[model samples]
Target: MKKQILTTLVFLGIIIPAITAQTTSENPYADSYIYWDYLAAYKSGQATVAFNNIDAMLQTYPPQKEIAMPRELALVSLDQLLHDTDNDQTETFYTFINTRMMRVLKDLDRPVEKGLRIYKLYNDGFIIKSKKATVAIDLIPGGSNAKPFIKDSIIYGIAGKCDALFISHWHADHANLNIAKSFAARGKRVIAPKGLWENVDPMIQPLTEHIETDIKFDDLDLTLHVLPGHQGDVLNNINVVEFHGEGTVAQTGDQWGTDDLKWIDHVNEKYDIDVLMPNCWINNMKRHLVGFGPKMIITGHENELGEHSIDHREAYWMTIKKMELLSDLNMPYVLMTWGEWYDYQR
Candidate 1:
């Protein structure tokens, strides 16, 4: 059934890509230009060759349209690959996703004049860019093993384009000492909690808790209001970021439990947020939505961490169920897979 759905989507995308509206696909399908040699080889048990083909293809894949059917195709393949334990021992899984992440880097070069453009990386990783400045939120290198998902150049490449890096918490997946160092070395601001690597790296800046405390980034032309949130007992910094003219966006970094609800329940009264970035899974999702009261919601933290357990990894299909629950609110939201992006105009 999954393969059938993927085939149908790809077939429709190939037919509709010719007609485009600037960055959007006319029909939300995709272009006819995806290379299928890798999928064919994967079926034939030539895993390494398939990985090589995908690597070559992703390195040069033209991102003319933002939402493509091919992206759906790639994600379906990734979902299957992560579960296939045979490939876990090999470098194939990480190689495929990392290559796609590099594709996201290619699109960031284009400037956004009117509103902020957001690129969704693996898990909670996002790149929010406007004409004024570029910011990376929870931008992590792929995989949890000693072997990194992305290369050093890709990490630095992302660091080079951004003016600041905002880390929500010290979770291994959300925060990276090396990536933080890249931003800090360039004199760009790196805001994280003083929990994980703060002692190791003094350059990391911890924001004051509570929304009343607004931290100013004069050099980057940005203002931040942080909610001292917690994921279980761990401190999670729920960032309410204000860009001068582009409008305000609130990012909830692994916000869990009822401890933060004191502020979260009244977030709507505090500020008018244009976009709300939140994890798809939480104990009280709808309440969080009402509190933030965002014009639109772009959910992250879907299908991340590692492939140790299928359930823990959190599949994209699960997000479909999550959105179904939130449908009654009539709130706008985008459920993006790894390497997908959405641009917002406020």
Candidate 2:
């Protein structure tokens, strides 16, 4: 009889807690909410209140062991907010987030995770928010055949969570159909140049919505602007998208419009961009700077996994410095590679 009682108690202990966890999932940040709140608030121009709430939340849930990505993000976002403000405001916000809000997340079992990467312009995490809705872009690993991306997991993870994805063009260097499939499996809506979508595998087709012109998917708060790409064929539509509250970033896709000032100027005229995330090839970048007018520039389409393909790192730096030289004409330019996410202050 005693043996039977002990077995039942053991079973109950294991089963009861899971049952309890399921029954009490009332907390928004409980399981994991990709925090679009901070981004949303920033986009809506509610900087102070947004800062206050996020700060309070972080302070209440300070980092602990078993770190989770979302919790770290809350802290990172709080840091960015305070850093963007005046010194006094920064200190106050820091105290609020670190001391109060973070503690709460900690209690809820949300601790800051490690392995997040930072670049000049991008961040690695599970969520990307426009000024409006927030979407989850979780990174998944690819096989050895996968095209190299700097900070691979970080980039792919967020790409996976994107509600609307942007494929610059069809070069294997630019488009990873396999990666797109992962995002598709989760019901994400991808936006790519029409040509790429046509050639993309059927598995990825269901996940995409194509736009042929300069248009905005307002529901997603994304603006799709197609420009001349690397090869310059009608099928080669290089896209630059503006994520509403996250500021504007132009994806050169695989094409760099190095020879055409007119097209780059056209892009500048069409969008009030904060950063330009483009492929960093000299033929593309040099001519790109003449017409590229963004405060920051990020390099993409470079091999992140290999040994700095083509000694490309130095060339990327030189191109950025040239852009900064132009910034001396009043447009500051900073070059970044992968591992960055756009953050905006509405």
Candidate 3:
């Protein structure tokens, strides 16, 4: 009798609540909402208050893959508020995102004792730091048509912390002119493929298309081995960099050419790589994985994108699906959103 009573209590208190939250999420406009109050506050111009409520809810719900209820809804709601809004509210939405990112940027000042600490800011923008040096790859302020997405002060702050920046290609989403200029102005090395911003920013050095040369810096304690790549016809430099004697970390910036795979499929045979940050939608990801052979994969290029089309914007759940389908490979991976960090050990 006591066992039956206890089981009933668990069903009502735990299982029912989870099921209810899941059901409520399917109809976002339903009055039986988990986050309607916060969403209302944000739309009504109390963004700070809305943010506080959302933050608190995040703490309460926490985050998990399957069991966690309403966390996914909350994230989706916030993403919708940011992306689905109009030009009138652009500044407010931008402010909300930048505020969160400011906290992340400040946190980078704290030292990491071992391995690599990688921080993700919007889209494919990442800053990877080690005990010896900090390297930024595909660090954009946002897309060209929609930028000043991050404040100059924030971009400058990023430049202040990093020793160098490596841009992959000429696309504005990946190769931000202002971000590269900020790094270059600090007398820090900025390298990209040839013909990117040619004659415009003389300080932006172009990497030659040869694999033999290892790009090194005078004051920076790091080396970059290049893999000349392409996104269709666009030249992309896949950066395989080693910092502070740590494990190899490779950054693939929009590499999607079949011809590029001839070399990419052989990355593991060439060198031992610890971390590989690949775009979530890259072609033949399994083939790319075997080639790079990183200990773990932290995916990028989700949700936030350049174009106005909602279809162009990839969601975080897509990464989750990719991971599940690729479970056979036994490669460990973590899906990350904006302002998230993953510490990887060699």
Clashing pairs in 1: none
Name the weakest run of 10 consecutive residues (lDDT summed) in model 2.
116-125
Model 2: number of clashes? 41
Question: TM-score of each candidate?
Answer: 0.77, 0.50, 0.78
Better of 1 and 2 by lDDT: 1
lDDT tens per residue, model 1, 276-303: 8888776688999999999888888876
Cα lDDT over the full model 1: 0.72
> Which candidate leads in TM-score?
3
Writing each residue's lDDT as its tens digit, candidate 3 over 80-100 gives 554554422455656666776
After superposition, which runs of candidate 2 have C-alpha atoms over 4 Å from their true positions?
A: 1-128, 131-143, 146-157, 197-212, 232-236, 244-246, 257-260, 282-287, 290-292, 301-309, 312-327
lDDT of 2 by residue, 47-81 (tens): 55565665445445433322244544554454444
